[model samples]
Target: MPDKPRLERQAMCDRLAMEFQNDWIVNLGVGMPTLCSNYIDDSKEIIFHSENGVIGYGPLSQEGHEDQHLVNAGGQNVTQMPGWPLFTMQIHSL
Candidate 1:
């Protein structure tokens, strides 16, 4: 059996976060994309958008403090930024 080497998830996220501009709006997907929030440069005012109607949310919530009402597209609890509005979509059919 042979062991395979893999890049640390956080390290990969830190690297990917560097590719965006300071004021860019990023739509992060599930899994690895979620990790990018924790590594983005603090100096940069990057806005994170989730498909689950979350806008301007910060990194993932800590254990035991997860909000059941607040979750990402991946169904993971997320923390919202101050003054950010949560949008919900309604579908109308004829």
Candidate 2:
């Protein structure tokens, strides 16, 4: 996929991110929608709400710091920002 132009991906992700940034409690579906959480700028302070017993789930884990047990439904591990919250998804936006 490295051969593919990154600008297209950036543009697509950016478009969706902008649409959701102003939304409160966005109920994002899975797949590409899940990837959109990574595009929001830090200044925007967008909180990524995830299932798998987490609420404030941040970006995907950096290289070599992955926790296999702490993964989303997609089986990819995620990183948690400082002061982020965790909760049972069944109790929240299910």
TM-score quality measure for candidate 1: 0.77
TM-score per candidate, in order?
A: 0.77, 0.64
| Residue ranges of candidate 1 with Cα displaced over 4 Å | 1-5, 88-94
Note the Cα lDDT for every prediction shown.
0.81, 0.64
List the lowest-lDDT window of 10 residues for candidate 1. 35-44
Q: Name the lDDT value of residue 84 in candidate 2.
A: 71
Backbone clash tally (model 2): 0
Report the C-alpha lDDT of model 1 over 1-94, residue by residue, as the tens digit: 8987888988899899898788788998888888777765777888988876678887779999888888776778888776778667789999
Q: What stretches of model 2 exceed 4 Å from their correct place?
A: 1-11, 87-94
User: Residue 54 of model 2: what lDDT?
Assistant: 57
Model 2's alpha-carbon lDDT is 0.64
User: What are the per-residue Cα lDDT tens digits for candidate 2 across 16-65?
Assistant: 88876543555344566666666767666666665545556666787799
- Alpha carbon RMSD to native, model 2: 6.5
lDDT of 1: 0.81
